[model samples]
Every structure is written in structure tokens, then in C-alpha cells.
Target: MKSYKGRGVVLHTLKYGDSSLVAYLLTDVGGRRSYMVQGVRSRSGRGSKLALFQPMFPVEFEGLESSKQQMHRFREVRAAFPLQGLPFDVRKSTMALFMAEVLYRLVRESEPNEPLFDFVWGCVGALDAMQEGVANFHLWFLAHLSRFLGFCPGNDYVPGAWFDIREGLYTPVQPAHTGVMSRECSAILRDLMACDVRLLSDIGLNRSQRVEFLNAMLVYFGYHLDAISAVQSVRILREVF
Candidate 1:
């Protein structure tokens, strides 16, 4: 068996039998892969080395060539970043789970996108390093992801123009559709596309406004993404914000 090593972001994990784990990870070189981990339920399973469900780990794996579609096997794994406060902090942890779920849904298997991978890894690092006002991480991430996913809405919303949600374009005519945002919401969304991740917290939105913005983004995704559903994490995010 040939073996390989790379930095990976853990997408999700499931209990395998009683003492093992099946972890889904997105590695920089290998793309997405599933690896079985053994003896994780032992008394020594509480620390950094086997942080299977958490993102941002450097993984060493053995390559099994029996099948082209074979699942990757991990020989070792460890955290690349010491997440001091993210797991313990409620808001940060919620953001991480929400983002993880989003990535798990969005990233396709065997798709090699170095730029997108780097972007996601950077977001994880930013989430860990964030000191305050990290509530807007998901919103910013969604907006940035839209750009990469090729669903970036037109930033040409006029003062009196309505957003064309299905078309992903801005127009002067009022939308015949119900999902389209109002002129004010359209303008706010235009601002979102230009803001940096840190500045996202400075957008000065009320809870209602934030919800509207999120809904608008989801509507855009629904038009673009085939299997994307309503994000369940939005409710938790709203409650937190």
C-alpha cells in the first residue's frame, strides 16, 4: 500500500462499531476521503491527536490501491492549530458547526479546487483566531462562497430597483416573484459583497434585517445549488445573534 500525507479539514465523523471512527475529511492533495480510525473510544481518546470531527488537522494516511474508489486509511492525525477557545466558546463553536455542515454539503467528492480549499481553511483559522464579533462569520462565508460558486449576484442594485432573485441580477423593474428582496435589502446585500470578514460584524444590522439578508442569500443558493436545502443552522445563528 502506498501512503500519503497532507493537511486536511475534517468534514464530519461517525462512530464505526464500538471503538472505531469513520471520518470524512477534505485534504489539500487527496480531495475528499473517508478514513477509518480505530480504538478511539479508549480512555486516551479525549485529546488533540484524534480530533476527528474538528477541522484543520495534518493527517498521515496509507493509500490502498485495491480499488480506485477505495476509502483512505489514516495512520496518524493531529491538530495543526491549537483551538484554545473555539470549542469551549458557545458562539464560536456554533459558527464552526454551522460552517462545517455547510462545507459538508457543498464540497463534492474528488473535486480538486485548491483555491476553494485554501479559502475554507483560512476561514477555519480565522474563526479560531477571532477575539470578538464572530457572529457574522457564516454570513461573510456565504457571501464569499457565492463568488466562488459562480452565483455572485449583480451589485448593480439601483435605489428604486428590485432584486431578481431567480435571475441573480439586479433590475429596475419590480420583481414578479415573492423571494426577491426589497430595494433596501438589495442595497444591504450589495454592501455585503464588498465587506471583509472582520468588517462583516460592523454592518449594523438588526436581527430582522440580518434574517432578511440570510433569506436572500438562501434564495440565491436555491436557484444555483441543485441539492441545497434550507440551512438549519440559520435558526441557531439567529438565536445567537
Candidate 2:
């Protein structure tokens, strides 16, 4: 077996028997991969190791890799970034769950993508430290994430242009298909594309507006990546934010 060392963000995990876990992670060295963590769920203090596998938690690990096996085994693991607010705060934790689910669904490749990995790694830290405009963080994340996913929407918003989600562009004529955003929603998306993380607090939206835009963005994402069509954590995120 080949030895590997890298940083990763936990996407999700599943119980394996009574003493092990199957953890899925997006790693800097190997995009998305699964690891069979042994004895992490045992009733002894080893169970505490499960904390390292929380949704979107960043960790550095040394592991053994094999050409014939899909699930690797970790030799050692530890937190890469100690988050200050994400674990204890309800809103941040909920957002982390949604983000993790989205990544798990959409980032299915096992090939290394350094740029994408860096973006997600930075966003995790950003979310943890963010104080204001936390409600809008996920929207910002999804919009920018599309850029890495290769389907970022065009920011050409004129007064009456509709956003053709299926085509990923702005247009003056209404799209015949139902996968289109109204001019109002299109403008909001345009703002999201231009807005920076530091300026999120300035972009204001009520709960209803936020939910509508999030749903619209999800529709746009679905057109490009079919796997993200039904994100389960979105409901809980909406209620919390």
C-alpha cells in the first residue's frame, strides 16, 4: 500500500458495524474519497474520535492507499483548523451541514482538483469566523462554488433580463422552459456574483427572499449537476436561517 498525507474536509460519515465508521471526505490530495476508520465508534474513549469527522470539519491525516481498494484506512488524523464558532453555534452548524451535503452530492470525482480544494478549505474557515451576514454566507458560497464547478452564471443583468438557469446566462427574452428566474431574482443573483465575502452583511434579504433565491439557485445547480437536485439539509437550514 502507498502512504499518503493531506488535509481534507469531512463530507459525511456512516456507521460501520459497531466499532468502525465509513467517512467520506474531499481531500486536497485526492478530491473525494472514503476511509474506513477502525474502532472510532467503540464505547471506549476511541468514540471521541468521531468528532474529527463532523460535517465540513477540516482535518489532516496520514493514510494508507491501495490501487485495488476504494476505501482507504487512516493511520492518524487530527483537526487541521480548530473552528471557533461553527460547532457551538446553531446557525453555523446548520449551514455547515447543508454545505457538506451539497459537496458530497456534487463533488463525486476522485481526481485531485487543487483549486477546488483550496476554495472549499478557505470557505470552511470563513464560515467559522463569520459574525454578521451568516444567513447570506451559504448563498455566497453556492454562487462562488459554481465557478469552480464550471457553471458560474453570467452577471450581465440589464433592467429586464431574465436568468436562464438552464443556459447559465442573462437574457432579455423570457426562456420558454420553467428553469428560468424572474428578472427580480436574476438581479439578486447578479448581486451575489459580484458581492465579496467581506461585504455579505450589506446584501440584505428577508427570510422569504432568502428562501426564494436559495431555491432558485438550487434549481440552477440541478440543471448542471443532477445529483444535487434534492438536498435534504436545505429544509433545516431554511428554518434555522
Write one digit per residue (lDDT tens) for candidate 1, span 72-148: 66565656667767777888888877777677777776766787778877887787777755766677788788877
- What is candidate 2's lDDT per residue for 208-234, written digit by digit as tens? 888999898888998888888768999
The TM-scores of all predictions, comma-separated, are: 0.86, 0.95
Task: Give the C-alpha lDDT of model 1.
Answer: 0.71
Give all candidates' CA lDDT scores: 0.71, 0.91
Name the lDDT value of residue 194 in candidate 2: 90
